[model samples]
Target: MSREKTKGMSIIVKTITRLTVGLVLLYGIYIVLHGHVSPGGGFAGGVIITLSFVHLVLAYGKDTALKKLSKARASFLENMGAILFLSIALLGFMGGYFFSNFIPKGEPFHLFSAGIIPISNIAISLKVGAGLFSIFVALVLLKLKPTSEKKK
Candidate 1:
């Protein structure tokens, strides 16, 4: 918690991480956006995004990483993601089909072509990414006390 000790890793590691984390996040978004046409989908892309933050934690330490993203925010975002995904599914009720693709599908291979699929993919990515981040935060923050300490 000391100010002096709260910094990240060595200069070299920090330099490399600073350069790479943005690219990792960008790639994750790309994967999510292109899910309908590409092999990678929401879950895979979300995991990739989560791992990038995890990489930051590994390189920088809990304090430094938590400053950028707190456990509470992660939990809130996870819930929001789930809600968004559910809402997208529920919209299908208007069309009388569960998870129906209501929006018009445009030209194939185009970024905006897949209608609800892309939206669903975004929702799933948010859910998956926030869930994984929450898990990572929990695991990193947890601490186990000795049995004797509990008795006292």
Candidate 2:
């Protein structure tokens, strides 16, 4: 197949992906935010977020997906997530414990009721999502390298 033809999947698949990708991303965010109150958490939410990108790549090709989230940006986000998470943990020192809950815990079963848990979840989600996406991009590049070399 020509490079253009090989870039993405069929139009039907692309259409479906376009329709659903945003919902997938939204759901991931929901998972991350509600993790402290529910079953899902940072890791699960991050995987969901990564899958949204993966779906985009599968349906619309790497060029489109990379335009949205470049590898460099992904690395930056990963680093920022790590720094944020570490900072949150370090701040707990003021509470006289590592990873202690320093912020006020509001009423139960409500948003913002978990002190720093939601913030930590956001940090973990950023780290895992970007890291996983970067790994996927690297693997995709690695697979393409040998194929292009063979053609050359």
Candidate 3:
């Protein structure tokens, strides 16, 4: 059985929760796009996005979201992101010096201003998403019972 939810939720509260979560997710995407010239980056934006899932878990309960993603999958995604980030950096050394930008640098403050920065942002996003997911799975699994059938 699921744990009892405290108190009766008002319609206003439910509406606000849904609206807030939606807004946060949108803002997270914005931050991810403006990361090149702005204060925020992929990692920060990704963390912000992950909070939406946390909020969902809080409002709807962990069981619903837990079924969507498993720990092993999350861990694999995280590892892939790390590899992508490193591969981008390694590409720099392929030309001559390390950390060099092979891609062209467009106008400053523009979407393509920083070479590889956007790619890095994408990688970081993947890493953050998966890392948080892994942590959430670990936390949820700790509370679940181990089901088994053994010979007596």
Candidate 4:
């Protein structure tokens, strides 16, 4: 296959994506981490994170995006996130309730102030981000499959 056929998009789009994709991923992480103190939380941050990968897929094609994060890895991360969140909630039983705030609440407006909340947010972001990305990948794969195979 020719270079243009294998690689996706124009050089300009690829260059711009290379420059901005990391920033977009970082912004998503920032949102997830600061969810307790800011307006954006796990769900919004997850969407942003998924967008970063989607951007890559659009700019560099499915092959490149899959190389960065394969279907198996995405599924693994999604499962891990759910497990972590569940473990956190289950641990709250030690505090006499489900999903209780067992960790010490530090000073307000600080990074570590919310304790378990931040941790929970991280777990949620992982689950949401990976799950959404997995869904996107599945849809892409489905669309790309041969119609005869799909019918079988």
Clash totals for all candidate models: 0, 0, 0, 0
Tell me the lDDT of candidate 4. 0.94
Backbone clash total for model 4 is 0
Candidate 2 C-alpha lDDT tens digits along 102-131: 999999999879799999999999999999
TM-score of 3: 0.77
The candidate that wins on TM-score is 4
RMSD (Cα, Å) of candidate 4?
2.8
lDDT accuracy of residue 151 in candidate 2: 82
Model 2 Cα displacement at 78 (Å)?
Answer: 0.5
In model 3, state the lDDT of residue 84.
97
Cα TM-score of candidate 2: 0.90
lDDT of 3 by residue, 13-92 (tens): 65677789889888888888789888898888889877877776666566655565556777998999899999998999
Across 1-152, the per-residue lDDT of candidate 1 in tens digits comes to 67665566777898899899999999999999999998999999999989889989988888777888888988888888899989988998887888988898999998888879998899899899989999988988889777997789
Best by lDDT: 2
Greater-lDDT candidate between 2 and 3:
2
lDDT of 1: 0.89
Q: Kindly give the stretch of ten consecutive residues in candidate 1 with the minimal lDDT sum.
A: 1-10
User: In order, what is each prediction's RMSD in angstroms?
Assistant: 2.4, 3.5, 5.1, 2.8
lDDT of 3 at 116: 83
Clash pairs of candidate 4?
none
Q: Evaluate all candidate structures by whole-model CA lDDT and list the values in order.
A: 0.89, 0.95, 0.78, 0.94
Which is superior by TM-score, 1 or 2?
2
lDDT of 4 by residue, 1-152 (tens): 68756578988999999999999999999999999998999999988999999999999999999999999999999999999999999999988899999999999999988769999999999999999999999998885546797678
